[model samples]
Target: MIRKHDSLIHQILAREIPQYVIDERIRNILNFIKFGIESGIPANGKEDEDNNTAETSAFIRQLADDAIVLLKNENSILPLKPEENICLIGPGAVERRTTGGGSASLNSYYHTSVADALKKKLGHDVPFAMGSLIAKNLHDLGEVVTNPKGKGFDVKVYKESFDVPEEKRTLLENYSIDVSNLLLFDYDPKGCENSTYYMQLEGDLTPDKTGEYSFREQCLGTAQLFIDGKLVIDDKTKQGLSSGIFASPISSPQIVNVKLNAGQKYHIKVEFGSGMTFTARKDSAALVTDSASILNFGYIFHKTDEEYIEEAVELAKKSDKVILCVGTSLDYESEGFDRSEMKLPGNQEELVSAVLKVNKNVIIVNQSGTPVSLPWIDNVPAFMQAWFNGMEAGNAIADVLYGDVNPSGKLPLSYPKRVEDNPAFLTFKSNNGQCVYGEDVFAGWKFYEKRKIAPLFPFGFGLSYTDFTIDNIATKLDGENLEATVDVTNTGKVTGKEVVQLYVVPPKTTTAVDRPLKELKGFAKVELKAGEKKTVKIEVPYKYAASYFDVDANQWHAEKGEYGVLVGDSSSSEKFLESTFTLEKDELWSGL
Candidate 1:
């Protein structure tokens, strides 16, 4: 009431105002503004404190909940009842790769490993199982069978050493591992190509321990994976993650297969001679000694989906419900390149398929930035969309699964049924070492709508265990500002949170860019019980609804025409009520 009167007073005071009225209004506004600043708002100091997106830990929980997509649940196999004596199978069930390679990585104090998490949830008496991964077992074979032609593969004295390249697969030439003997880090600071550099091995490794070893220069060709005297992978194969920026980790867990007695000493040497030298990468090293990090991060490294299924089926049989936490590994997903396909990498799809054959009921939790083709989504009962939900992943998922929190996250991107459906798919492959993001801001949902191609899962397409109803889409215009209000109610048995979203559509003549039917302007996450309801008011300036940025004009132009306001759940399909509003050239911006 006072705010409206004050605005009126300001407009009416173009000529003058009573001295007493001016002083009283100024003092009230200042006092209210001061109180708001000191109240610990979300944004401050140039930050919009009114952005309540992450006002509390609920945002973390919402992100965690929304990212967990239950891919498969055949029978009532999930939310496993508390029964002891179950086994934890597969390499992943023990150690999880919370974060994959590249920029989306963060180091943290503690991470909840599935083993540790389950152990904490279930007591010490729970039985655990470890299965032989065919892929990893084959890796074991490669290391065990190869002896440099003289060390004797069957020698009882097992002394192993491996060189992890400093620059991912820096030695990746023609698809063959370009390994360097020098234990040094190599990175092209200037993006140099085929450059020569030198580094020396300074670690405790010696050459004499492996008997008399001599340098053998073999013509190694392209192949990410190479075996004794044979090239298993090469340039023609598209397993290109081994290229420049990937720095894919080698499957050399065999590094720990052998033992080195501390008292013994030996000298080892590998003469790089006069060849190109890249840095050697050290495996996940510890900050100190034998102290294990609270977080267990490493890949299960299954090459094919069949391999994943074989490992997963054994796990499903052992436990009451199958918590098949699966997704693409670093090799299949990373920066510099989009994925070749959108299907769940490896045997995840196949794993989900096969798991249903044995135990009809299973719960699939996935982690990825995009949607994967769930050929069998119709067969599954429960799903989760666990999209790289940072350090809070395991805790948040566990919290929701155990009914500790209500899932309130809305989708930020759309998921196509296949990689082919995406607009960038035609020209997406890495070309000339550059995968240009020419699509500009019109990516994901915007492009999909523009091209008339549909996404398998639309943006803001998150599912909640509860339901919400949005009513009364009304707008009020005061000068150049608009206030949007909608009534939201939780009309479900369970308590849940609702993401009240607001979207704005500019007039056709305002701008000529690829505009979405509506762009997300504002959203509010509110918690409510089964019979609870509340009116959420979201305010927007004409600038927010106006079309800005003209590539030709290099200036913002707002046409005096009609605009549309949409409020809904998903960016594409949802029951949202909309109303038409207007903007004028002069009303688009407020110099004030």
Candidate 2:
């Protein structure tokens, strides 16, 4: 190892970095630490005051409620009737996936699952089934395992490895953790920050149904699982490469099947050593190493995909209405890696198809942060996009389904009818460690409109329970900004919100440069009561609304020509109310 003084990189950094800059950074860090300590903040982030208050929670619920987009609602199937016999089916229904995984993941104070929320609203339990398994890894055992006191898990930390004798090992700390998906990237125990450590977790599992249970273990370090004091999985010696927590290259989960009995308590123990104990060769892509470790283990009762689908179909056949909650969870659509395909994980498509055949009164609610292929789009009468909404996700979704809240959220991005329709379909992945921007300016709604390809749903597209009309459009130049105003009336019998989207169509240029047919410039959302009219005004800088970057001039240029302004609810041209404005002379400028 090279000393700091002898290292060339360190020498250069010292020479280039100013002393005051370094001092300022250190001072800021010290001040932050002082504030945290003085404020009596808990290191574990479990303080009572840290939890969301009633008001904050309500606000979060409202945001989630408004952000849900009603993509498709035919025959007014939404706002489910109270008397409808509803059945909730899918893996997402039972999973409390409030957020995505990786850095975006967090341990919420509490969260309600869709199944529980629906049950509460109905005043009784509804027919439910796990139609398919979409988890890329084993399911978390946090909800299944408990300690002697009926708690999550008992954890014991040590400075020595498992190879050391029990009496010789030095105990470092002991605590209780509520979850099995442990990401210890920021874990810094007293006196153990720079040292290798080991942990032992003990828990008891009682299954409700007897079956062959499958347990899986994956770790950034080395780990072993024991059930009833028998070694079930040993990931310490041999390991396989896969992306783990923090995008680190770690072992692929090792699974073992054990026959378990119903209502019979089983003793569970796990021994884990820090990354220093890992014997695998260092991978170039691995981010975490000796400084931290991650351990994710889970278990589930073994069942075939066909059996699960059959059960859901049976429930759908008997119910008067079905809410099939299907989509990718954190396991499939997290930050670590890009999804290889656009289709739903596992046999979810099959489950949706099967359910639709049995019952036509079905509503599909997809909870995903990104787009997923909907093969049954034409078949389903109602569909919704519920992105990963934090703690109040279930409550918000319940509100929309029962008509307590009107969904006004519009699609932020266009959904391609097929993956092939995407602008970057041919060059989406990296080639020879270099990615080509093949699509150029044609992206999202721009690409769809330019190619005249109809998307599954256009950007800014959303359906409301009530109807709205847009007319009397006008525009004027306020200095360098163009202000567009339009009269909106809630024509339906109920109150609703409408988004007024403004798009600018630039004049056809004789130059070789090509541009999008039309581009969205500004938008405003307006809420109105039945038979009420409201004028909404949207303003955009003239350059921002009508200019394109001129490569030769190295600046944005607004050509001296007529520019058309289109106002509508979505990107589809047929729905737009058109008007025109002209610039007397060309304008060129740069910088914010």
Candidate 3:
């Protein structure tokens, strides 16, 4: 409010906006605030509550069922029988990560972890283990902190990290907050004008289960963890930049192992510094004004990496098949920070590798918003990409695994074999304060097609428990749009959905500007039963396919050229049918 009001005041002083207009806006705001205060507060339900009704709930489940994409299925190992004994392995197995970290996180009415969902569906015990520790951040530690008043932590912001005497140190804000995760940017503390700021968080931690505990710190800047007055994890000097959107200035978790008994109390003090200096790649993006200041600090019940690996392998040996839930976590990939690399974080690589050696019937169910390097792709028989499906994360996985839902999701983005194969690899990050998009227009499949690079998984690639074939493809010009119609036949034994992708392959043009070899023009998702055939039509604007941005003219002009329509299930699908279409004359468009 202050910031907006200050801006308005500046505008009024500068006479940028009329005084009457500003007055009316201020009056409207005041009236709304008065009305809200007088009318009391409305009942604010949880985010999931809006869709908690029966119809909406079913639609949500279907949405989840449809969004899941099957990337690989070697020897037809998917759609596991419900009666089969399955061992759920990996940290994501029991954890209900229905959402990502930061602002994308959600508070739901109920959440069913994969372990719980599997148990419900199988109607028996589903053996599970923490194959790896994908530690929940400080904010997710809701019930562990025990203070005198209630469950919360005490926080104090200071102007400096050290050298200030306790009595002389100025207090910025000392308050009790419910969550451990703190975004200092939102707080906007006073008296800290420099790039650096410090914080001290005090809390009481009581272990519910007696076992070896591990504490770690993950922050954009630097931090130290002190348990019972003994320094455990210190990441003060370990500051670096990362490509991940949410986990920037990435520093590996500096963990410390400690043993504690159930119900035992420990005093925890976390000291933090908000800014760090680091050398980034010459092409790294500069720190924008809206860059995040995050603290994903917390500790979790710990087991040795070797211990986790052994237990998962043992579980895999006992079961008929293993549902190895693996992928990047919120800390590895999120909204603000781009991931530094494509590899899975921490000891996950070792865990999966060990599990694969003993179990050939391993089904890797990966959950991520984007691609992660799968070094063991060939070793696993089946793989599915369950990108952050909402509230029913576990139930959705069970639905697909138990053959209740046929996977029909298509990859929205291409999966690179390695980070180096990415079109923007050499110029992905910005240099100094400038970012150069060297591979403009030729992103994703276009880049791969142009460079003759084979992606691990091409864009629009997905498999189902059934089969589909695109036949009798036809294209016609209707008014200002090009209509491409194709007959989609489900020849397999089960009912499933398929996303029909339409790509426009332009002919050789005399224009000097660079252009992609082919571009996605339209797409449609159609469901069909076994032996059922449906004709699906996708419409693409004639100008969209025929036009290219003209820099000199500062407009988009449709070149007088011939183009062909490629219809298929995926970008790299060999089953595509081609048909040509032409534009009669040149056309120009301005102002999107």
Off by over 4 Å in 3: 1-56, 103-110, 134-140, 143-179, 188-208, 217-256, 263-295, 432-434
Clashing pairs in 2: none
Q: Relative to the unseen true structure, what is the C-alpha lDDT of residue 57 in candidate 1, on a scale of 0 to 100? A: 44
Displacement of the residue 328 alpha carbon in candidate 1, Å: 2.5
State the RMSD for candidate 3.
6.8
User: What's model 1's overall lDDT?
Assistant: 0.50
lDDT of 2 by residue, 339-445 (tens): 77899989999999999999998899999988899988999999999989888899888999998888899999998889999898999998998999988999888
lDDT of 3 by residue, 405-489 (tens): 9999999899998989999899988799799988888878889999999999999999999998889988999998999999999
Q: For each candidate, how many residue pairs have backbone atoms clashing (under 3 Å)?
A: 41, 0, 12
Against the true structure, what is each candidate's TM-score?
Answer: 0.61, 0.90, 0.78
Residue-level lDDT of model 1, residues 1-592, one tens digit each, is 1223444557567646567786897899999989988897645345333533444445654566655643333352444555633444343444334565444554433345455656666665344333323221122121112233332121110011124444432332211111221111233223224333222211122222322212211111111222222333232122121122333222112111122233343222221211122122223221111111110001122234454456657666766555555565443455534566776643456666777776655555665666678787677676667666655566665665555565666667777777777767766766887877767767778888777887767777666666789998898676757778889999977888877777888776644566566687777777888989999888776666665565566555565788888888768745778887875444333332
lDDT of 2 at 31: 100
Which candidate number would show the highest lDDT if scored against the true structure?
2
Score candidate 3 by lDDT.
0.77
